[model samples]
Target: MSAGEELRARLAVALTRARDRSAALTECVDETELVAQHSPLMSPLVWDLAHIGNQEELWLVRDVGGREPVRRDIDELYDAFRHPRAARPALPLLDPDEARGYVAQVRDKVWEVLDRAPLRGRRLERDGFAFAMIAQHEQQHDETMLATHQLRSGPAVLTAPPPPSPSWPPAVGAEVVVPAGEFTMGTSTDPWALDNERPAHRVALPAFAIDAAPVTNGQFLEFLDDGGYRRPELWSARGWEHRQSATLAAPQFWERDGAGNWWRRVFGVLAPLPPASPVVHVSYFEAQAYARWAGRRLPTEAEWEKAARWDPRTGESRRFPWGEGEPDSGHANLGQRHLEPAAVGAYPAGRSPLGVGQLIGDVWEWTSSDFQPYPGFSAFPYREYSEVFFGGDYKVLRGGSFGTDPVACRGTFRNWDLPIRRQIFAGFRCARDVVGA
Candidate 1:
């Protein structure tokens, strides 16, 4: 295929996957569910649907196609930062049917733009960056909507076949040692990488030992059984206070049945806790507390990246744990193929060269580092994407979750959230300094 044809093909695949995922999220629910604010933490599903279309129209149709705005009046209504999610349902927002029709119209225009536009010339059009950005953006909202589905109380509205059963031996709680050295962090050449992952730079690190896989539910349960939450010394002052205020006994959605067996609610269905599966819906404070209870610490962003992407044999950084290849079903559990995380250590083929497993999917792994910019960071397209969130307030998360789409995930992909937030699909692996290394 020619250069432009190849770019077009990639963009087409990304956009198709994004649109399909978004449709799946909305189509499964009734109109009432779409408009209902499941939680104050998320926008109404209808709002997300329309906002996706609006963004595509603004970027692909108006900017790329050089066409007039289709609905200029509602632009501010969809501006995510302008209004909090709790207030979204109060606005004169488009209903489900109207939102779907609006998106369909915008998509038709976008396809027209894609057909005739030169995929080369302007910065946004060159190499199809803008198209990829929009696809990623839509998929991100799909993830957010999935979170809403999890938060909403009612019957199950979505269903998907489970991921392939584990074929590899379970991780035996072994820790892999990474020697002290400098490895490249972030991405410089990845065209679709956001501004936060830009300007790849070298980072020096001390020798450390990291868990081979994410901490599992069984492991975390042991902590809880041992009064990990009750001990003030095991938690930071802020974490202890937050735990006390929230009265958090276990991970969100988890409860002990009348028989004293652990169960968790999954998309409105209550099921027994899978002992081998990696724990999800954990906040940074919970992760930190678990690490402390285990006499380890959460890996620094540099440490986690090095363990996942640094190849010791070549002394080079890879795009993913399994190397430069695109992820497949054999590699990792992503793209909502499974609503829940696969059993830990199931994806041996996706393991890093150093034998670390499940570094890219199953759940987003929390890191010790704060969300900050690279040394030579520069915002592209807009500042709201990354600049506004660059601070110590938000903790960094690496890897992606089962709800995440492949187009939006990479080894260098950065995710951040408030330390106290537990609604996200987040987990962590413990790390510690190597003694006498």
Candidate 2:
């Protein structure tokens, strides 16, 4: 088939996927309902949905291409990025049906124009890339919205977890004794990575004993029982402040019932906390606190990458704990059933050379390092992604969440956010500088 036909086919599939996502999210986001409190992260369903429409339609189809938008009237309707949240109300907006129509119109136009069009035009790729980016943006918001709906409101659907994941890595209990080595950390890329992952650098390190598995809820519960939260000495000042302010009694989704039984929200369903499951939805603050409480700390980004580094010639150690490939059901709780968080240790094949449980995708492990750009780092085409936050407030987060796009989980892909945010699908695994045996 010609490149043009291929583009259409690809575009068709992509649009269909986005549309499917909208349908899947229908149960999660109800425009008529009041926005939940835990979701201070977003403006409103209308705002977000409309923003998607505007971004997909106007930003990609017309503006970036130097063409006029199809709907002149809707140009500023939901342009929340350019028109900030404070200014969002001033612009006329669309209801769900209208928003969908706007999205469809843009999607149709994008497909039509690109079908037989030149890929060489700066206008097309520039605009097309925007849509690609917009799609990613939507996905990020989608997971957060789901998390907020459950945390701030109530569980979307109450059901038992589907059951332990049927798939498991072949080497159930393998060990990757990663040698102590110095390596560059953070995303060392000239290409576009989020600001948090930029300014990669070389760091020296000594040997350390690294865990092959993520710290499970069962393990973390022990720390909690041992006064993980109450002990001020175990927390950073910032972390303590967050704990006291939120009055956090446990991990974000965990609840202690009248009977004192522990339950956790797993993909809109509440069930008894799985003993072997990796504790998820814990924020950076909480992760830090837990690490200190356990006499450990979050791994440095350097330590993480060095251990996972692969030397193909040596075959000595696996660079990717699960081998050089994308994650599947056998590797991590990433793109698959979409029903629930799998049990920790469910993906043995995906384990790093060192024995780590659920390192790749079950949850986003919080790292101790502050989110900062690497030395000699420069901004990407979009300046806002990395340059704005170089002052060092954000914290580095690692691994990938269950629903994170596999392509987005590259080792260099840096994720950062406020420490107190526990409503997202982030979780942490503990690390420490090597101590005397």
Candidate 3:
């Protein structure tokens, strides 16, 4: 195949992968469940179903293909900025069957555009960026719908095999030192990287230590045992206030039996907590308090990126933690292959040059840095995607989660959310400064 043909083939596969996953997520439930707002934080599954199609129609059929809008009447109904998740149910939305049909129609138009549209020239078409962007957007919403499934109170409807056992356990309290120096952060060459992660720049830093693997459920249980939540000193003032108001005790979805043993609900299946797996469904406040109790801090975005991407041996950065290679099942727990995080040290192949394991998948790791633009950032296509969300109100998260699709994730991939959001799959690893290095 020619180079352009190859690009089109990859884009088609990415789009198909995203759509298949979306079907799996939304097809398991009945229409009532699809229309019900499982949580105030998440849109109804049907809304997401239609929203995905709407976005595809807007970007691919209308914008890129230069075609008349497909169902422009419903554009405002699906516009995320126009309505909050809590209010979506009240608005007239396409039913499950209608939504499925609508997305299928939109996709038909997309494939027509993909077959003939020049993959080069215009900025949107350059390197097939627009197609990739839409695919990523759909996968992101699929993840959101997966979260809604997790929040739904029902019998277990989704199932997957457990993640593989680690070849060897990650040592207790293991950390890898990133020596003081400069390393390139973000990316300028990544054709599909979103605006927030653009314009690669060098970042200088002093010596510091980061966890070799993400903190596991066993370690976090220790924090809970020691009154980690009750002690005010262990939390920031704002964190403490939110903790008290939200009645934060354990990670969301956790339940304590009369025997006082902790169990958690995963996709509607109640099971005992796995000590070795990285803890998920935690908020930034909870992670921060846990770090404080452990006498460490959350890694900043730059610190996390450097640890995940920098190659000390060669004085350069790698595309992924292990190297410049696309992720596979053995490399990381991604793409909903497993519904939960694998045990730390499970994917030794995925470790960075500095030996930071599980950095690419499992859980979205919270960093100390607030969501902000990198130096020389500029919005393309639209500003609502990233520019509107840049501020201190949101905290930066690096690395993708088990729910994150590969097309939407990379070392330079940036995810952010309000600090108190715990419904999403999020976790953290601790870091400490080295005074003299």
Candidate 4:
């Protein structure tokens, strides 16, 4: 296919996927459920629905199409920075029916703009970046809406086939050694890469060992059994305070039966904890404490990147752990293919060159590094997408979770959350410096 044809095809697929996922999530619940704020941490599902439409109108219809705003007055209603999520329900926001119609109208105009716009003329339009950005934005909200579903207390309204059963036994070696070297740490040429992932730079690091797979539920149970939560020394001062304040005893949604066996609430269904799946819904503090309890440390962002993307033989970075190919069912457990994480070591085909498994999906793996910019970072389109979040307060998360759409995820893609957030689909793999390597 011609370049424009290829871009249009990809854009069409991404847009369709984003819309479908959003619809599926919203349609599963009644209007009351859509309007209810499931958690203070999240906007009402209906708000996300309308907000997705507003953003598309802003970026694609107005910015790219040069059209007059359809509902310019409503922009502030959806301005995420202008209104916190908790207060969004009180705003005069579009209801479910109105949101669907509004988004449909905006999407119709966006399609017309996409068909005729010179895809190479302007910075935002160049290489179809604006279209990609909107697609990514909508997919991100879909993930957020999914999180709201997880937090909502109701019967399950979502369903998906379970991830493939493991094809290989659990990894025997707990950790893989990454030799000391300089590795390229970000992307310089990826057309749709966000600003933070720009200006790929060389990062030199000492030899280290990282877990072959994420720490599993059974393993984390051992930490809990050993008083990992009660022992304050295992946590950072801030982490300990947060833990004590929240009275966190285990990962979110976990409960013990009268028999003392562990069960977890998954999409409103209480089931025995899948011992082999990577532990999810844990905060950064919990991950750090677990690393300490295991006599290891969380990998720095650089170390985690090297393990997942760097190819020692080529001395170059691969777009993904497995290769430059787009993610598919064979590559990773992503795109809500499974409502929960697959068992660790299930995706051997997705392993990195150095043998790291499930680096692209399953759960967003917490890294030790703070979320910061690259050497020559410059915000594009807007600063809020990433630039504003650059600081020590937000811990960096690499890899995507099952809730993450493939169009919105990449090896260099960065996700960040506060250390105390436990509602996100996050987990961690431990790393330790190789002494005297």
Query: What tens-digit string does per-residue lDDT give for candidate 4 at 46-159?
Result: 999999999999999999999999999999999999999989999999989999999999999998998988889888999899999999999999999999999999899898
lDDT of each: 0.92, 0.62, 0.94, 0.93
The collision pairs in model 4 are none
Please give, for residues 107-196, the per-residue lDDT of candidate 1 as tens digits: 988988998889888878888889999999999999999999999998998888977667775555788999999999999998889889
Ranking the candidates on TM-score from highest down gives 3, 4, 1, 2
Q: How good is model 2 by TM-score?
A: 0.82
RMSD from true fold, candidate 4:
0.9
- For candidate 4, the clash count comes to 0
lDDT of 1 at 202: 97
Winner by TM-score between candidate 3 and candidate 1: 3
Q: Identify the runs in model 3 with alpha carbons over 4 angstroms from their true place.
A: none
- After the best TM-score superposition of candidate 3, give how far the Cα of residue 375 lies from its true spot, in angstroms: 0.8
Question: 330, model 3: CA deviation in Å?
Answer: 1.3
**Candidate 2 structure quality by residue, lDDT tens digits, 1-437:** 97556654654555566556654654445556423233545554555655666666655576555556777776555544576544554455676677667767776777665554454456335334444555556666555545545554544642233535535532322334455555656544323244455666666677665556677778788888888889888888988888998898798779888997899866556779886667877888788887777677778766666655433245333324566565666767764245456666577667554555676776777777777767777764366766776666788777777766654565666677778877667777666665442
Clashing pairs in 3: none
The local distance difference test score of model 4 is: 0.93
Off by over 4 Å in 2: 1-15, 27-31, 34-38, 71-92, 120-131, 152-177, 184-204, 266-268, 309-324, 435-437
User: Who wins the lDDT comparison?
Assistant: 3
